[model samples]
Target: MKTTGNTILVTGGGSGIGLALAQRWHDAGNKVIVTGRNAEKLQAAIAGRPNMSAVSLDVTDADAIAAFAKDIVARFPNLNVLVNNAGIMNAEDVSAKRDLTQAEATVVTNILGPVRLIDALVDHLAVQADSAIVNVTSGLAFVPFPKAPTYSATKAAMHSYSVALRIQLEGKVEVIELAPPAVRTDLTPGQSTREGYMPLDDFADEVMTLFAVEPTPEEILVQNVMPLRTAEANGTVPQVLERLKAL
Candidate 1:
């Protein structure tokens, strides 16, 4: 994927990883637009970033998604990059009395949200000379994080969807799956300060470097995420599950 000269839209760009990525893309000379449910946060995120803009979007809202897609394409016809990054992370105790609320939201936002948006924009993307869809999944997809079960499950489903989407869009649009490790971000409350999470700046820089490469790989696996990325292949699911449960 070409790093510059593309109009890119990043969901959940109000803060954390999504914000960091949107900023990086803006700095790299791309026409970057960010979206989130919080209008204030979205505005704040793009503040003073002349090359970037913000739109209020609730990915979980089906009607809003279709309207937003239509408006976005009409407004920014040059758009060619879509980064499906909006998601929610929650820790659930399966053994305890469980409420399906968070899990349902996770499936809707992390899985259905991207699929819906892709359906809305695929036609526009296909007509463009060069286009890319970047899906932000997680390392937990390969090895579930016991506590954040629903979040992990959603990412795993997203990974599978991305694989099929790539094959289907073979020559029309490039599909990239960015599976992140435990990064210093507030994906969950206080997750940013967690002991083993990668420093936000470091992770962001490395990710930008990977994208800068002339031909980006289908999967963007940074060093920290590599272990989990290949965990399934090594028959380490049981071991990884135990470690996560201990946490």
Candidate 2:
């Protein structure tokens, strides 16, 4: 949207992509509130920040989401932007006799959490002018990463959901999907310092530019994420799959 003067809530905003977005928006004069399960982490993220705050929220907990939504709505009555940025990624070997514990958890945090939060806030948003909902999916949503199968699947689900949500909320709220590539974030252990990942600041810089677009685009796709985002349409799925296999 306009990128400024809106009250925004971002889940999993303690670090990584969420942190970057929260800070950038806050800098642009928006009152930004970030949430995380870890209270300490949330505090640390906004330690020296003005116009930015944090709240403890375990997105996987339906009850917690409900309470947090009520509290947040009362606290920030002008809230108009909800960024569904909280997500988890883990490597799962489908070939093995797996318990699927992590996979189930991934579904809860990555998919259910955002859906629940949206359900809680949709009514509030519909009444606000120029409201927006930003769902953070991934480049992997377009091409599955063999190792993180469930994570990719969850993101794909969000991608599909965002499309429908946009049409359904056509006049009431703006629906946007931000499909991030392999950014330098610790979405998985060691991913922060890993090779072949985009630098966090660099990615954030590019993303902020996209967010400033007038008549905001439905999908914010950065340059690095374009290949996979367009892979299916260009008939490069096989080639992309092979490349992913190597990674």
Candidate 3:
């Protein structure tokens, strides 16, 4: 979490929040390699971006992830930071019998994706100096968003896993959970232009400030997310849920 001079790998960096942060880190003097499911898009994202590259990675494919990990490790021997930012969000109505395809995919991409990637890279990271594993969860993890129930659940699971992983790698590696509010990104249709959500640049700027702290915080909670992040602890879950439902 030194904020600079580290080789960082960010998944789902083709667009949205992932790409935004990857660009910021690249600007901050780090060697950044971003990955996504789309090779063309990934290449386009890194076009003309010095010291920044892109690779294709289908997080839903376990075998692919394993192979990608090996190849990436071999290619970037100095890699010490892994950002598990790739995830999917979808809306579903659970009131009646419905196809669970979307829900299932969400679980695979958001939950198992990070687990598999971490499992593949944790050992390599442990031996490297200034190693860190950053998991991008959501504010919905603490307060569920009814519309994207499965997405919310997956993030919640990741938050819990990050906690345990931090304890296990206490001395060897840094485990950080980045819980974002409804930032103006295209995580969902029309979300990028949403009025009530935090601006993408604004969120990334605050995140960079937070990362610059001497002792990097374990949880990166932006101002907009504070209500949701602290809802349960503050006994404001009901209020937060109502507010999110209207979003």
Please say which candidate is ahead in TM-score: 1 or 2.
2
In order, the Cα lDDT scores of the candidates are: 0.92, 0.94, 0.94
Q: Which stretches of candidate 1 lie over 4 Å from their true place?
A: none
lDDT of 1 by residue, 51-89 (tens): 899999999999999999999999999999999999999
Per-model TM values vs. the true structure: 0.97, 0.98, 0.98
| Best first by lDDT, ranked | 3, 2, 1
RMSD vs true structure, all candidates: 1.0, 0.8, 0.7
What TM-score does candidate 2 reach? 0.98
Candidate 2 residue runs with Cα over 4 Å from true position: none
lDDT of 2: 0.94
Q: Which ten residues in a row have the lowest lDDT in candidate 3?
A: 238-247
- Per-residue alpha-carbon lDDT of candidate 2 for residues 205-245, written as tens digits (9 for 90 to 100): 99999988887778999999999999999999999999999
Q: Give per-residue lDDT, candidate 1, residue 88.
A: 95
Q: Per-residue lDDT tens digits of candidate 3, residues 1-247?
A: 8988999999999998899999999998999999998888788878888999898999999999999999999999999999999999999999999999999999999999999999999999999999999999999999999988999999999999999999999999999999999999888999999898899999999999999987999999999999999998999999988887886
Candidate 3 regions off by >4 Å?
none
Clash pairs detected, candidate 2: none
